[model samples]
Target: MTTFSRRKALALAGAVALATGLAAATPVLAQDCEKVDLTFTFWGSVNEKNDIENAVKNWNTNNPCIQVKPMHIPATGTNYVQKLTTMIASNTAPDIGYLGENQAFQWATEGKILDLSPYMGETPDQQYIKSTIYKAGDTLMGTGLATGVMLIYYNKDVFDAAGVPYPPAKADEAWTWQQFVDNAKLLTKDRSGKNATDPAFDPNAIDTFGVTLPSWWGGWYPYVMSNGGQFANEDGTALTLNSPEAVEALQGFQDLIYVDHVMPNPTQTSSLPTGDVLMQSRKVAMSMDGMWRVTDFAKLGINWGVGVLPKWKTAETVVLSVPKVIFSQTKHPKEAYEFYKYISDPAQVGLFKSGLWAPHEKAYFTEPDLLKTWVQAEGSAYPPEAMDAIVDYTLNHAPQQAPVYQLKNIGQIMSEAVEPNIQQIMNNKATAQDAMDKAVATAQPMMQGRW
Candidate 1:
């Protein structure tokens, strides 16, 4: 439960002492009788780190023969990758670690990570959500540590003050893009108490924005898919960012800031706090964000509600997670897999109750009792409507694999082409079509085929 800074120093010292102790002890007659040490590396918030450390402590206490050390890496995204890569290069990779979906595939292809197929068994997909299982051809790389899906989080007080009806919870009853925009307009008000629909409404002096459209892929990708767009073709051999469907969806989001004026622009949004804070303070009426925000919203004590995302041709969302994988260089594969299984289980970890993660196993969705263990659990913090808005929608309406899971070299593509051009489009410096066309040109050559 210690902070990362203190935990890092203590872990290193304990590892050194453990190594010395084992080296000085009399040689054990059987390999099974000898003590085994395994390291698990991961990156996340302080709460998540504490949760994992507690799990490791419990495992170590219960299993004296196989002691697991928790290695806390307090970095995420590219920085995490950089540190992990340095460890691998120095031949000091942990037995297992949390890896981004894109990097998991890339590493699996390079044989840097172990194929977990033998441990998970044939038809691993039968146990886990098919989308969350990472593979290179037939070789299973790893499974998601947990699953996450996007949802429309709105401030009930804001909608009530504007006399606007709440958005629908079920996918079948989802609002159309136009209807969503119309509602957003009604909720958007200027400092003079004029809604966006009012002719006298001043955009320059807005008191509250109707929405905060996410510029990140997790926020916008669902809309693109719902509009019948694909980031790449099924084979993942080419970039399809310039497709008509993609152009339309991206433009529609941009229009929210420019033409509709219901959303804040890049500069304006940068000055605002995160989505959860935005809703709590009523600075924005609604936000399209990951369900993980439930933890923050619950603590903020905001009067909030969950709703299915608005649809274009279909109501769709993306489910994703960072996978925990066993390294190829591990000296104790058996012990590593054991700890991996222990930590990945929702029932074993405390993350589910904090609303930071969802169960990755298919049974959690299909089995009523298992579903209630997390969704309806006392400290879960999920809104009442989450059963329909998130769980049901994800199980029935959402695509199994998000673009990040399907596309190869996605991290590079996002950095080199997608992110930069998308920012330009959001800034109103370029049109969606023009920006995507430019992005596609740069990303096409980087496509190395999907996993």
Candidate 2:
């Protein structure tokens, strides 16, 4: 894996400047034209919203003829979807907005979203990471604003206290499943100072959990894939959640809580603080989460480190991002596309500086000069090993596109079948095999071929 150093990053400051200059060189409206107002709808935290508003202000200042109105929605998931659906129903949809992968494909198929292929100049594939570009067969539907991968976030202090070696930063050297569980057992301690490994350790009076086992599909799907299991077949025409590989992988996750007694269960986690706070307070030694958490961990001043997830059979991770699309109802297609392109560039949008996002373009990962622009910078929120744990792991170990990016009707399938069954397994109400068998049976009819 490629390793980055502070010296290399400092030396590449000139490359960062040149890249910024090129990105800012987009031609401003030279001739007088009627000003077009376009609304951009999206959801994010206060910081993210402020960044978008600032970017819009800059765009409006330069391109007077194409002023963009920023519409900030504070909600996400179902509420955001509901609001967006209502807007579309009322024919009041914004010119452009962020859409989840499932909805982007569904809307694009229904002709509710614009086909961006026409607006994209030749060689669009070369502009962004292929996985970040959302498409429906030959039609370009939308593109991810940024990309993120799943990985481990550990508190260095907790690891040192427990005398446990830190998880591997390099993907190739990732710990096996058993090793991760064993370390977690060592790290987990009770109020009486007994670790989980001790015979007298009290699970009910735990002081610190070893890790967090996320119930969400995004958290566990990679492990399933690592075990050569998949939720569905490649084309998404069949359900395969009940396969032996998937069942075994899921059972292993459940064992971390019920058998290994390291990670906290759902009821225990509900009363606990968020992941960053848990790590900072020494309530949890480690967390499995998306790379976006780097921003939160950095702000808390915790001595944290990034690491590749423990592997079952192969080192694998999921990469995902919200799709940014132009609404078909927009009257000003040209202006909307222009604004979309502007925000999609990391140089124009300042979110990258906070480590909340990774660039969607491939050059950012492959080109040493461009890689330094995001991965290694002065005062960067990213940890020292971010290049190997995140950048290199993402480029080499992660799937080209996660199932969420390609699976048809994935949202509905998860909501209706997969999530509920997985929840049952987490709650210990059902065995992994039985729960997954039910999931397959329930989701089989809902399956639609992949895009």
lDDT of 2 by residue, 1-451 (tens): 1224322433554323222122342445664888888999988766678767887888887788888899888674588888889999998999999887778888888888898767663434654554687887666876777888898999999999999999999999999999999999999999999999999999988999999967888878888999999878877888898999999999998898999889889898888887778999999999999887777777888788999999999998888788889999999998787788777655555667677789876667877656655667555678889989988887788765677777889888988889999999899999999999999899889988887
- Cα lDDT of candidate 1 equals 0.79
Model 2 residue 344 lDDT score: 62
What local lDDT score does residue 416 receive in model 1, on the 0 to 100 scale? Answer: 94
Please report the candidate that would top TM-score against the real structure.
2
Q: Compare the candidates by lDDT and give the number of the best one.
A: 2
User: TM-score, each model?
Assistant: 0.87, 0.91
Backbone clashes (count) for model 1: 0
Model 1 lDDT, residue 171, Cα: 97
Model 1 ranges off by over 4 Å: 1-35, 64-67, 71-77
RMSD of each: 8.4, 4.2
- Residue 427's C-alpha lDDT in candidate 2? 91
Deviating ranges (above 4 Å) for candidate 2: 1-27, 121-130
Poorest lDDT segment (10 consecutive residues) of candidate 1: 15-24
- Alpha carbon lDDT at 189, candidate 2: 97
